[model samples]
Target: MNGILIIAHAPLASALRQCALHVFPDAGSALAALDVEAHTPPEQTLEQARQLQQQLGMPHTLVLADLFGATPSNVAAKLVDGIHSRLLTGVNLPMLMRAICYRHESLESLVSRAMMGATQGVVSVAATAPQNQSRRTSHDQDQHDHQQ
Candidate 1:
């Protein structure tokens, strides 16, 4: 199985992991997180990442970081270059959740699935809502006219 790791600036990595565990309930062991603090030396952070890699154990791990060029991503990039892991940036709840749901798949497949989730999760709702909202608005106006 490919273990999952999330790395991001302070709180975000852990925060996302916490939310994922809340949904998965049994993901505490399979999924790990590393939160990068401003003062934390790169070497120490890299060490922790090494341990996380061990904790996950196995063929590979999928490491997700928040920003591509940020500290969290940079630190993670260092450790995952090893054969046992792969890294994807711009980690989000949707991607994490999707990955957790399908963790048993191959790392490459999970990467594609999770990436789709992350990309699709980012969207803007139409300025005008669908027909349901329009109908509700019309009904509300009719009620107001009746009261008058």
Candidate 2:
């Protein structure tokens, strides 16, 4: 199986993993860490990721990061030249779950799927509503009844 590296900002990795577990349950297989607070240091994260890639014998590593241009992302960037890894920014539960589910996929394909999952995860409730006005009204009524 391909390896997954989750590097998030501010210790959010643990929570992200929990969310992933909630979605996938059996997804406790990949490697991940939360280093947004500078606990592990960027250099250490890079080394660890590289070591994990080597140990897992995966052709490529998929790194899901919390923010773009942040420390975790930058650290991942440094390893790009030496390892077959893809760095994705703005990672969320949907993206992580998707990556883990498709971990065995090629690096390029996994990255594309991850991006799509991330994009689709972000949606306005109104946008998800039925196009028919009556359906929307009924939906709103149901929501109101549930609140009462």
Candidate 3:
């Protein structure tokens, strides 16, 4: 499995790691995080990233950041040399879980699965309500008729 690094603002990276570990205890061995604070210097964070890559054995690690066009992502961008290191933004629990589950897959496949997982995780409650809405409406109508 390629190494997994999560970089996010403040506690987000750490929190995501913790949450992922809750689901897959063995995943803690393969994942790490760098929480970037506002005062964090770019050079220092960049060096940390370099070390993380080295720890992950480089070029085969998937670097996930919390936000695109932001500091965490900016730092993560420097790691992508296009050799084998891949960078993906918008880190979330679902994406992280998918990555952890599919780590055995090729880097490309893992990235694809993570993206799919993240995208599929987002859902609108209203969209799901319609399935049982008719029953609810019928019950309410019956109650209203009795009241009348």
Q: Candidate 3: where is the Cα deviation over 4 Å?
A: 127-148
- Tens digit of lDDT per residue, candidate 1, span 58-103? 5789999999998888888988865668899999999999888878
- TM value for model 3: 0.83
Q: How high is the CA lDDT of each candidate model?
A: 0.86, 0.73, 0.85
- Spell out the clash pairs found in candidate 1: none
Candidate with more favorable, higher lDDT: 2 or 3: 3
Q: Per-residue error at 1 for model 2, in Å? A: 2.8
Judge candidate 1 at residue 73 and give its lDDT: 88
Off by over 4 Å in 2: 52-57, 127-148
Clashing pairs in 3: none
> TM-scores of all models?
0.82, 0.73, 0.83
